[model samples]
Target: MATTTGEARAGTAQPASLQLPGIVLGVGLGGFVDGILLHQLLQWHHMLTSTNQDHIGVKYYNPKTVSGLEMNTVWDGIFHTVCWIAVLLGLAILYSRVTHSRRRVWTSRVLWGWVLVGWGLFNLVEGVLDHHILGIHHVYAGEGQVWWDIGFLVLGALLVAGGYLLQRSGRPFDPSAPTRREARRA
Candidate 1:
């Protein structure tokens, strides 16, 4: 089939997997944000805070006590480990999708946009399952905690929509071609 220069360029770009890699990466990184910001820094809630009713056989631990804090920390470590694994997996998938050098794809809006979507998705899934369904932990906890949970979901939805728009507008990356800097030297 005859192809225009743009079509040819786009065709050679070896279409980026816009969603999977970024979302997976975003989910992992987002988990870090939750773990670091909410769980550790702020000392708001832990993995098993509201699990008394959620899991009948689960042991309840109060965050204020040293013993309870130790258990929560352990659970947080487990959560972080899962997030780290996710990041590694995401990177592997992203590496497989790129046809040429990663220069273009790494810097492209599409990747970052999908990342935002992924982060948001993480919030939605975690918020729904842990916060709402299982009653594990709340974003703020205490008065008006539901609002905070709802806000988390809202932010996730916004990220997905915004990321979709940004990803759509991104130019098809052709990393096999020389970057502008390399082109200038040529």
Candidate 2:
């Protein structure tokens, strides 16, 4: 008998722990995108991009100064390292969840939605703490950069909303249902 969505949920429903892997993956991947696009490709900003003006401890991020730029580059490297670790950890968790756990939530919509939520969360928290509160860096890192920072937050919010909606829409998904590939394997 083909399993209905209802039966799948009841028979092999994903527990709370199942969501962890997807969320972690999302956060890590999101960080990579930000670091690569903003830090490298766009060259719009860097870790501590505008910290010099804050007069904080050892301001070392003046783009005009070679030393300052070097300092910023070092910090950016550190940030990227952390992001890389997150991605690795997430992958480990996901692998364990899929291989060991009997109940797998493979619903594409649900997984992607949670991932989006995770990414949005990363953006919001990172933006608020690093950009606004800590005064470490801004998105544009120049005069009147608040607007750019705000825009980043706005984008994060939108991702969060979209992800949330997608997740809700997939509430009835049945991950236990065998796909054609699984049938072929069997």
Candidate 3:
């Protein structure tokens, strides 16, 4: 008679761990889009500069130094580089999984879903803090900016929720349960 231990054998495959790099990448991508398009490309406003200005007796002078422009660009570039690194790391994890021929697991999906959830949460929190609490910027800088920002939050939430649902559905991809086909042949 053959005996088997309760625990899985050493050669047994394990599910992949949650991918942190991917999560970071997703968050970084969102931040990059916001900073690049909103702050830099479109020139809506400078992120690091203060809107408030003080006036001197002889001449109206802003607190910001002339070097603020260069500083802003450098800051933006650094932010972009960090984001890109996150993206690349995420891609590396995903690609390694693909190359290894491992079965897809619910945990992997859940991990990715959480990343989206985290990103959405970050956006909502930062939006409220910066626009409402700190008054650094108006919620709606232009005619429709508020709507757009709200939409972005909503979309982020949906991505998270949808990914969770996909992982939980548990439908069989192969359409063959381990025993069903054998029973049919017998």
Candidate 4:
């Protein structure tokens, strides 16, 4: 007897707690992508790309000059460290919460959806704070910079919406229950 989607939710763990770990993980991982892809790989911008005009009294660290490159590199390292900490914290939270077959949780759409939510949240927050409010850095930091920044926020919004829908369509994870494959086998 194959269990229906509704049956999967019967023994699910607390949804609130279940959603957290993935979100934290998503935030950290998303930061890594942004940092590695935009800042390092492409060399499009740096930590303090336009900070000189941010109205925060932050001096611009031009990525071209030796001293500027050093300062920017230091700030980038700090950003990466923060992302790493978030990932560690996420893992710790997941470990403490899941007592049974963590395999189920690992395969859960709900958790992954929450991760998407977290990533989207990161983009929205970062885009607003860094690109819009503080003017620390834009996505491209050149002509059509506003478009690039807006596009980032748009993508974030899409991720949040898409993830929410995907999770809603999924069955809840029941750790102790037989997996779908197992149920089908029997």
* Total backbone clashes of candidate 2, pairs 3 or more residues apart or in separate chains: 0
Clashes of each: 0, 0, 0, 0
Clashing pairs in 1: none
TM-score of 3: 0.50
Show model 1 residue runs off by greater than 4 Å. Answer: 1-16, 53-57, 174-186
Worst lDDT 10-window in candidate 3:
54-63
Residue 28, model 1: lDDT of 95
Q: Can you tell me which runs of candidate 4 are displaced by over 4 Å?
A: 1-14, 174-186
TM-score of 1: 0.83
Q: Work out the TM-score per prediction.
A: 0.83, 0.79, 0.50, 0.85
TM-score of 4: 0.85
List model 2 lDDT by residue over 68-98, tens digit each.
7788888889988988888798778766655
- Candidate 2, superposed: residue stretches over 4 Å from native: 1-14, 55-58, 100-107, 171-186
Global CA lDDT of candidate 1, please? Answer: 0.81
Global Cα RMSD, each model: 4.1, 4.2, 9.8, 3.9
Give the clash count for model 3: 0
